[model samples]
Target chain A: MVLMFKIFKNGWLDIFAALKGYELAGVLGWQDIRQRYRRSSLGPFWLTISMGVLIGALGLVFGNLFASPMKEFLPFLTIGLILWTLITTAVNEGCTGFTAAEAMIKQISLPLFTHILRVLWRNLIIFAHNLVVFPLILLVFGVPLPATALLAIVGLVLLILNLSWMMLLLGVFCTRYRDVPQIITNLLQVCFYLTPIIWMPNLLPKRASILLLHANPFFHLIEIVRAPLLGTLPSALSWQVGIVLAIAGWVFTIIFYGRFRSRIAYWL
Target chain B: MTNILINNLCVEFPIYNSTTGRSLKNHLMQAVTGGLMGSNEQGHVVVKALHNICLDLKEGDRLGVLGHNGAGKSTLLRVISGVYAPIGGSIVVNGKVTSLIGLSLGMDSEATGIENIYLRGALLGFNRSWLSSKVKEIVDFAGIGDFIEMPLRTYSTGMQMRLAFSIATMQQPEILVMDEWLTVGDADFQEKAQQRLQEIISKTSILVIATHSPELVERVCNKMIRLERGALIAA
Candidate 1:
């Protein structure tokens, strides 16, 4: 019991110390984006442009195929894809958060949590860039701003909280097992189709939709934000699921992270 | 009052082979079979990097760690720097610690020299305001005229080292840890760097350095210990 207490204390302290280094994480995060597109004339707008093209192309093809009207379908698809990208990129990058900083990890003693924050921050920046397409989509599709849109901020905060834990857990695991990254990438690919990013969840009959969509944790995660941004309040189920997942995920992650946080440098 | 108290510290590395050792499949199979298949598959190898080491360093102590390659010198320094948590025993450190082990680890080649000052400085735990205050001094000490405005990749190796060395020594640490004496830049800069390094070492309350050079230990450190195959052999 004493050992467990010590682990929890150290884990919490690691996070608290890392929080003091947020400026370092933020700068490194911006550098990742800037370095990736250094020579390009358009710079990070390239992220905006590519995501815009994908949303435009997919919106037209999928909207016609599903026979959903363009007015509602485009905004739904836009928000869904944007949030999905944020989730997947954060997870994928998290797998390398420790391993990628092998030099810094071995040589210096920065808090391990700082690397996880860097991954999340980088993906968040990318998510912000991709979000630039949303306002443009709203303009083109003539979607009205709704008061429910403010709720998306709460959803976003919850989503970030959930992603942070996932990143910490995956970062520790992936550092130890080299093959875990490939497994994660493949699993996320499968999840992309399983989740309703491109398709409308309402397509299914009422009973089936409720069972399938409500059961999917990813659907709720995306819905909490996407639903609010699309001018409708998310169902209480979505908010409940989001809150429950955040708490449960953090609880599990803190224990796991605390248990193995010290061993991360050795694994790398 | 700055000190480092380590008691019977042990550090071990689990050396994982590519195929079976570090794979999720192997771990799952182990869970399923228990010890049935343990003999055939080569189990993970564990290398003892540091074994039952105890040391106490107080203020104004300059301790040199002398070891041959693979003798755990780097590992010991890492443990002292708080990078590697000892698998056994405890270490109580009562001072702010700074490591000069990898001076250029976080630097960005795509970033200009001035930007890298902030980048590397922040990685070393210096805040933006402090870094901003020292930017001009670091730039001047580095003496890479006008290169500060250009991307670091454009600078030659010596210029890069100069900038890295300057930024790394900007702060006075309570406990300073180093892997070796740094020899940076051309002869002129090397002389200047040596002087700056000596100044920092003198000001730091406790110094831990690992080096192969006995001459460096004799010239600088007040105490010295030698290690062989992860065990302390002499003091």
Candidate 2:
């Protein structure tokens, strides 16, 4: 019980301290984007352009193949792909949150959560860049702006909350076991197909769709944002799943982080 | 007032090599075989970086640490800086601490000298207003001139070090921890750098520096200790 209390304190306090360092994380995150796109004339817009090209091509082939109208299918596919990109990239990069910051971790005494925030914030910037494609897709397809679209912000907040905990957990775990990152990359690759990004969940029969969509947490995460933006309220089930995952994941992460927080620098 | 109270502090590092130590496969195999294969496998190696160390530092104290390579000098400094938490003991630190262990740790080579000033300063916990107020002074002291607008990668090694040194010493920390005495740039700049460093050290409440040069410790420190293989041997 005493050990549990210690772990709770260690994990939560690190997060509280890290919240105060958002400015540091923000600057570092922006620098990461700038550094990656340095000397390129298009800068980070290249993210939007490449994503735009992929969405366009996939929309063309898949829309025709699925025999859905371009107007209806394009917006759905666009939103799905954008949210999927955020989830996949965030998790992939999350695996390296501690290792990539090895220099800063070993030398400085900044809150360890600050590194996790840096990774999330960096991906959010890329997510924002990719979001540019969404507006264009809406404009071209003439998808009417729906009142439910504003809820995407709330959905995004929930999604970010969920991703943050995953990053924290994976960041600490991957630091100790070097092989986990590779395993995670391969798993996420498999998950991309398992989760509905390019394909529509409606394509499956009702029973199969329910089983696949409800059981897979990523589907609920994506649907929370994508559903609202694509002109429908997310099912009550999606919100319930998202909220539960956020709370549960954070509880587990806090305990895991507290137990292992002190060991991260050693692992690195 | 500034104080650093440490008691029976211990730090151990588990060195996980690539082969058997850091792989999930080995761990799973060990679990499957129970204790059967665990004995033969070369598990992770643990290095006791710091052991049963105790020290008390107060305001107006200048403590120098002397040791050869891998004698835990750097680890000791890091523990004080709050980078590595103690595994088996307790440490209570009051007052803000700044470490000049790696002056260029967070600097970005792709960024301009001016941009790196903010980046590195933010890592050191300075807010934007504070950094904005001191940007001109940092630039002037670094002496990079027109190159301040150019990317850091364009700067020569001495120029980069000078800029890093200037940004690192801009704030007067209550507890100043350093790995070594920073002497950088050409002869003229070295004189200026030393003067700046001395000025900061004099105003600092507590100074903890690790170095090999006995002459440096004699010149700068009033109290000194020596560590041999993670154990304090002399004081």
Candidate 3:
């Protein structure tokens, strides 16, 4: 148990040490974005173009299928899809943060959290590219820029915090159990459907149990960001759940990282 | 002030069988089935890579680690570098360390030689401005000429080695840990590399080199130790 305490303490300290290398992490993140599109004319804007096309196509098809008007549907789907991309990209890439950088991890003595930061930063850059469509979508749908829109930044900040913990937690786990990445990929796929991304939660019969939406942590995450962008405050329940889950996730991560931190290098 | 003190350090690695070691699914199955099928096959097998290592070195000490393959020489270097924390005992190291175990370990193959130098430099904890200032010195020493602008994958193995060697030895390290005596490039370049390496060694406060050649131990190192099956053998 004393060993575990030391490991945990070391793990926490390493996280702070990694943060001090934010410049290195940011540079690495930028290098990744450039390397991915090297020699391509479009460069990172390709991300924006592809996302624009997907969102437009999905909005048209799903909007018609659900018999929802375009104005309401586009904003709902747009905000949801954007937040979903941010979440899924971080979660999916987090699984490989340490495993993919096996060479660097073994060779360099830099903080392990630096790798997590690099992953999150890279995904954040991609998310920014994807955001090019958000304002345009609002303009096309005539969604007003309500004062509440400022709160979306707060929601975004919270989302980033959530991703930091998720990446560290998942990165450590996936690095240890090689098959964990495959499992996580499959689970994220299932989660996409279960989350209220494509379909509306209100479509269900009135007075029907709201357990499906209420229980989903993803929904609250989306609501907090999406509701603010749509010019309204998210339900108190959403803010409470999102904040509670963020704290709990980080608490769980601190303990787990502390215990298994030393084992990571051996597992690799 | 550069020193390395390793006291009874131990490193253990669990050697999981192919079916169970690399897969979480197998572990889960074994757990669910109460180990009915995998009780024997999936049993934990741990390799004691290093056992009760005790050593100390101070400033200006050039130590050569001699051992057979899998004798934990590299593992010891890694532990000293802080890449691996000891499971038992402790290792105290003072001064900054530069390890050249795999000189090109973090270099990107698809990136240009210049970009790779920067990448490798970053891995060694050098900022861009610092690496940029040293780029000319490294490029001249490597003598790769115009190939420096080309991607690393286009370079021959020897050329890559020259680049790696030059970049690794460019800075005067307080503690220099190397895996082997690197010999690359033509005879002319080899002579130059040796001269530069010797100069660097003279300035380096501490040197730990792992090698099989007794001649290197005699010529370059003042102290020598041998490892067999992870245990330090008295020299």
Candidate 4:
């Protein structure tokens, strides 16, 4: 189709630029980290320790009430918590990606798409550090690492790709509306309980649980990625939903970026 | 040869007066949101910064701008540099441009003086290797001594001004734009800063400076124009 070809052609530069921009963003991120930890004794290790304390506390209390054994519960809880932290913090922090950098954006002529890439790249580096807690927990539980680990990494790549576009859309909308991110944050907090992160999907009433898993992209997002990390393959339907979400995310993000591309210079 | 064509450019800024036209609903929204969307009825005034203006400059043209504040001097520079778009005309600028509009636009105060040097360099469109090569040269020019290792925020007003001036002039570009005075630092440093400005202006093909400093304007500019309101007067 002519329309499909036009869409592909338009997005080609964005994909190429995103990769290049991410590399520069990584250097900027390293510069930021060194600046933050340069004088401090603890350095970047404090990030993992903080995550351990918060997740451990929540896991202990919730595991008891939810009737799942401590050994089984902690790993599930930790993985879900870590991923959600990444998703939420990325969306929340990215709201001001341009506004916060008014000084730099106004001064130089940088590709505005680079800002979206920068926020995603920084959050990903944080997520990389937080992953250390997961393997350490798995080792403590006497669980053997499986070949499924490779599959989970593939899932992680997909999840990151998906989240990158989601943040791009959310970041632009949030900048324009101001109230949108606050409302989205509040709703995500509520969705934390309704989604099967701390609790098992099996425990839910069949219809409601199935609906949540199929209808809510976040549910499929968590399962496809988290299930493999748990050394168990999940429902094939999650994969089905994931592929569709990927397509939708890319299309939506392209439209979002295209519409607001020029106005970004003025908003800052 | 670098040539810049600016045709029929116009810019306006909206001023929102909350004190004069504050409504109860606007106040309530402000209290909850901490920032306003600043739409109609809560007061808006338009100030046209640049009127319909046309100009053409080829290589070896050093144009000086003289105007009072809010008289569209900086606004003209911004429009030429592509930072602000003209509500009306089109601009055709051929060849690379390095703008030094604010002098020290992106310097992070928390960063060390050396780090700020590299950061500032990248911001002005310098690559890693070019900046690295110029590191010592820039530091020596700044003359801030060992304070280059300390946070830039700790630098005195004169020291910060030296760093900003040193970094902008270090890079040689086809077109150099100076907004306001190049006499930034103290009397001693100002002499060195002005010399650097002269050096860059000589090397560049087109030099457009927007400033109200009468002495500096007279000394450097071959062609000078004064602006009243948004219209250019006879040179």
Candidate 5:
């Protein structure tokens, strides 16, 4: 249909245009990170310090609760928390992509996706800061840095790609209906429990419950990165699930974006 | 060449129910429970912001738009700037447009004045290298030497206006769109701003200004139109 074709064209244009504006988005993203800690002496290291405390506390409590050894549990918990923060923060912030930039969106005709990329890029910077804690945890636990660990880059890239589409989709959706942001937040909160960020899927007694992990797009998303970082191959299923979600989400987003892209200005 | 072509353009804004205006819950409930019977089951009141209108503009055209409050002056400017898309008809614009509709159009009050220049400039689509070369010129024109280091909120309203005006007019745009006459700064700075604004306007190929001052229109515009309640009227 003409609508579908229009959406396809608009989607590609938006993406490439956003990429073309990477310098602007990159600077904006850095400004956000800098502004958040402007008055502080430690600056972004505060992120690392707070994350260190969080992972430490969670590692101790959960390690005892799960009765897993310190060596086994700490790295698992550390990687899980870091990846979760990267992902959940990206999703939650994506909802505000347009709404938060109401002044810019309403005043100028900048590509809408630039805001989305800014959010992702800002979160990635924070993720990079949090990643500093990972090597220390790995050293403390003496986890081997096998050759497979490099594969995490592929997973990280896929996760970023997937989140970009989600940003495009959710940014437009939430702008029109303000309550959508809160709804998304609540859903992500509930999903946090369901997706095994703090808990392991293997602990589920019934084999049928493993289907929960298998079906969860979030699990596959986290697993693709977490498994590789833990010195193991991510299940082929995670890659398959991640790629499928990326394709399907982009298809839906393109159509939805094409139909609603113009409405965004009105919505704001 | 700078140009804008619009045909039968109409823009309508949907006013959602007061309670459901921004609520996803009400919208989703209406969608799922109301079935697929009608799209307007949520009961939105639509406001026609701009009626069917046609206009053609090209290089060397200085079109002045005249309207009172709620008379679609800002809306028309926004439509031309591509901030708002029309609900009907079509528009084709060929130029790099700079919208100086608001004094602080893309500024962050919490950000320092120096940082805001880069932020606003980037929002206007200027690349880093160009901005780097223009920074000293813009700062000098703003005339707030030490204040530029402080947050914009700390600056006086006039100082803020000077900074915003300086940034907006730093580059010669192909299509310059403005909502009102930007007369800011003290008497001394005002004279300086006037000369700078005149220089920039001369460089612009197509200029669209929305204002209430007939003297301004007579002085600057070659063509003019009036609007009443979102409909064009005889000028």
Candidate 6:
């Protein structure tokens, strides 16, 4: 109830700030994205080319190593790699959000939360670009593009909503702890193996697969999201777990963000 | 009363000691041989930039600031700008405050001088058409020849200050905060800058200038505050 009122009071200011941040992020995204490929002949096509090669290499090597077919495996790995980049970029940048904005924070009286939101919004723009490669890879691999393709748009919305609060919570906590990002990085590296992104879920036995589906939020976020993009939406039960985790992530992040949002400047 | 209430403020600056690298071999060597002693000492003791400070300013107050080297003038400007958060005490501010202490530093180095004026203006909460309509006035006041279209990095310091001063003064905020460095420049801009400042002084509700110069303090300020060792001294 207290949080509700606080948001209500500061709602207009926060929204205006976020809008300003989004505009700035779009400009910054253009620069960052362009600079990375400025001298390269292919420019943004490099993203598509590099991702295609990465998916191909991983599918060939890892697929052969694990005795999986290269055809179906390519689509799975391509979607997984794209999603992985988004998660990694958001988490890593979110961790250092305060430090990067230290100059702006010190110079202006604007809210510190603006910096975190700006960084996340920029990463989201990049994610949008990388997502272009996902469908192309799926199409090239002879997958049927279905009417459920609209689910990808919904998933993107959920991803942003869920990640926004996660960013606030993690951004604040990381500033205070300083070691939190490192710990999270280490944990995320391990999660990659157990989450079954590169590997299909059916490969696991019934019990283990269901357990992984329920317990691992990343898997569910990706699985539910990639399900439509990969031509396979999750069952309603799977959707339950994904939707619940997404809501829970927002709740947890918001609570932490609310507690420390006012104190972040001092921490930095 | 339109006043600013400031309690204790302490800002610490940390300079990392790179004498000892972070490699494990350095750790092992330090365990046995202690790579460098100064690195360890500098590592722990932070420079107490501002100790405990308390003050209040009323409406129509033109307060002159004085301090020495390593004095917290810039830090104080930063704190009031909402850049540096005070470690202790509470600050109550009334009305809109415009800070021009590091005006040029915030200008985008890659952008044209004219474009940077708008960028900096937007950062200060001005809208598009507002800056658009005011662009020519800002450019005329800056007094830069033809270089307004060039990147800021290409301009001379005096040229940069011309643009900076123009942008900084664009908003005649209720409270205007400035650093003493505003007085340092070529004579041409100085004479014009002084006239502009005088015009602003009479109109502004509150003006706080940090300077070691008694002339700057006495001529422009009706009130004075001296700081020593992070505490206020009687004027």
List per-model TM-scores for chain B. Answer: 0.88, 0.87, 0.86, 0.81, 0.85, 0.78
Docking class of 3: medium
Which pairs clash in model 5?
none
* Displacement of the residue A202 alpha carbon in candidate 2, Å: 1.5
Of 1 and 6, the candidate ranking higher by TM-score: 1
**Alpha-carbon RMSD to native, per candidate:** 5.2, 5.2, 5.4, 5.3, 5.4, 6.6
Tens-place lDDT per residue, model 1, B128-210, is 99899999999999998798999999999999999999999999889998888889999999999999999999999999999
lDDT of 5 by residue, B8-84 (tens): 88777765543444355345534421111112334664556677668899899999998777677788888888889
TM per prediction: 0.94, 0.94, 0.90, 0.85, 0.92, 0.81
Candidate structures ordered by DockQ, highest first: 2, 1, 5, 3, 4, 6
User: Which pairs clash in the backbone of model 1?
Assistant: none
Model 4 Cα displacement at B203 (Å)?
1.2
What C-alpha lDDT, on a 0 to 100 scale, does residue B47 get in candidate 3?
61
lDDT of 2 at A198: 79
Better candidate by DockQ, 1 or 5: 1
Candidate 4: pairs in clash? none
Q: Can you write out model 2's per-residue Cα lDDT over B1-235, one digit (the tens) per residue?
A: 7899989988877646634444554464444211111212235545667788889999998999998787889999899988899977999999999998778888889899999999999999999999999999999998989999999999999999999999999988899998888889999999999999999999999999999999999999998999877778798
Candidate 4 Cα deviation (angstroms), residue A116: 2.4
What is the interface RMSD, in angstroms, for predicted model 6?
A: 3.7
In the range A213-254, model 4's lDDT, one tens digit per residue, is: 677778888888889988889678878777778888888777
Question: Model 5 over residues A1-268: C-alpha lDDT tens digits?
Answer: 8867977898778777889889889988988987898878999999999999998998888888988788877887788888889888998999999988888778878777888999999999999999999899888777777688899999999998898899889999998888988998999888888887677666787875666788788999999999888878888899998999999998888778877888888787
The global C-alpha lDDT for each of the candidates, from Candidate 1 onward, is: 0.88, 0.88, 0.84, 0.74, 0.83, 0.71
lDDT measured at residue B219 in model 2 versus the true structure, 0 to 100: 95
Q: Which sections of candidate 6 miss by over 4 Å?
A: A1-45, A66-71, A142-144, B7-53, B84-88, B106-108, B111-115, B136-140, B143-152, B181-192
| iRMSD of all candidate structures | 0.9, 0.8, 1.5, 2.7, 1.8, 3.7
